[model samples]
Target: MRQPQQERSRTTRRRLVDAAVECLAERGWNGTTVAVIAERAGVSRGAAQHHFPTREDLVAAAVEYLGEEQISELRARAAALPDGPSRAEPVAEMLLDLYTGPMFRAALHLWVAASTDENLRAVLVPLEARVGREAHRVAVELLGADEARPGVRETVQATLDLARGLGLANLLTDDTRRRRQITRQWARILEPAVATRTVRESA
Candidate 1:
């Protein structure tokens, strides 16, 4: 049901998007040019431009691409959690893993660059909002947090905020020891608040 040309185009676009994400993660926004992406993707500059006319367009598309990938990864990780009262800590650890990885690094590059570039901001703001919403939804679902409960949503968001802060620390320094310590401590604190039966019973 698909034409050869259309399939080829899709493949090329995927390669370009993947290459752009790698560049953003490793080189930062200032160094991730179309030429470099094209080379990394093994596509001609013309082909890359044909797919993404501007750098902003390419970066925006890459962000969306990476967001979808991260969401899929989150869903898979959440699905792997066993049904039990003790799922909170493992889920929290998984969430922290998601926040501190390469995808997060690529996103940080975008956030930093977008802070100063209006054109990039125009593309990043809505994408960032959507990613945040999805992350919140996945975290709440995985932790079995009842959003309708008075403070449950805030508690879940606070966990994400803490993980994000630790991830920011990871960007500049080796915060592995602190990250583990905080995750364990926070998981203990969140255990009662995010208990599956407790939240469901409250709801």
Candidate 2:
């Protein structure tokens, strides 16, 4: 039926994106090509091109797709909260996931490539900005306490930045618990910073 055909098309497109993500993560950004994605997806280059006309098009979509996939996981983590202060635990946990998760690993790989490739930066910069802003928004929406502070955004973003750094450190050293502990400590400390800033702002 027409619906089945449409579903097949959608699945193929999703497969291409999944293939691209695996290729990028496993092979690194520069190592991945449209041909490689096609091969990984079990599709012809022409079929891949039909879905994504240019190399950059596929790269950008892969980045956005990976981000969306990760955010979905984060949303589920957020939703699992118990509807009270206890919810902050999962929020901190989600932040941990964004930093150390597979999707972030792929994203960081793309970022490393984008740093030197101006053309790639053109494709990736917007995505990075969106991800950063969205991460901050998620922290505020899900984790921020009452009497929200003016500098809460900074605290949350800083926590993310530190987690990212520590994540790479953990990647090289295979030290997951160390980085997780750092994030947990920062999450506890950030609340007071927010309260202090809120008091100052309210005065």
* Highest TM-score against the true fold, candidate: 1
**Lowest summed lDDT over 10 consecutive residues: which window, candidate 2?**
194-203
> Candidate 2, which segments miss by more than 4 Å at Cα?
145-148, 193-203
lDDT of each: 0.84, 0.71
Q: In candidate 2, what are the lDDT values of residues 1-203, reduced to their tens digit?
A: 99999998888788888888787768788788999999989989998999999777887787787777676767776776655444545566567656665556667788888789888889788877887777666666666444354666677777678767766775655777776676576657754654343334445
- Please name the candidate that would achieve the greatest lDDT relative to the true structure: 1
Pairs clashing within candidate 2: none
C-alpha displacement of 106 in model 2, angstroms? 2.0
lDDT of 2 at 118: 88
What's the TM-score of each model vs. the native? Answer: 0.91, 0.85
Model 2 scores what on Cα lDDT?
Answer: 0.71
Q: Residue 111: error of model 2 in Å?
A: 1.5
The reply for model 1, stretches above 4 Å from the true place, is: 198-203
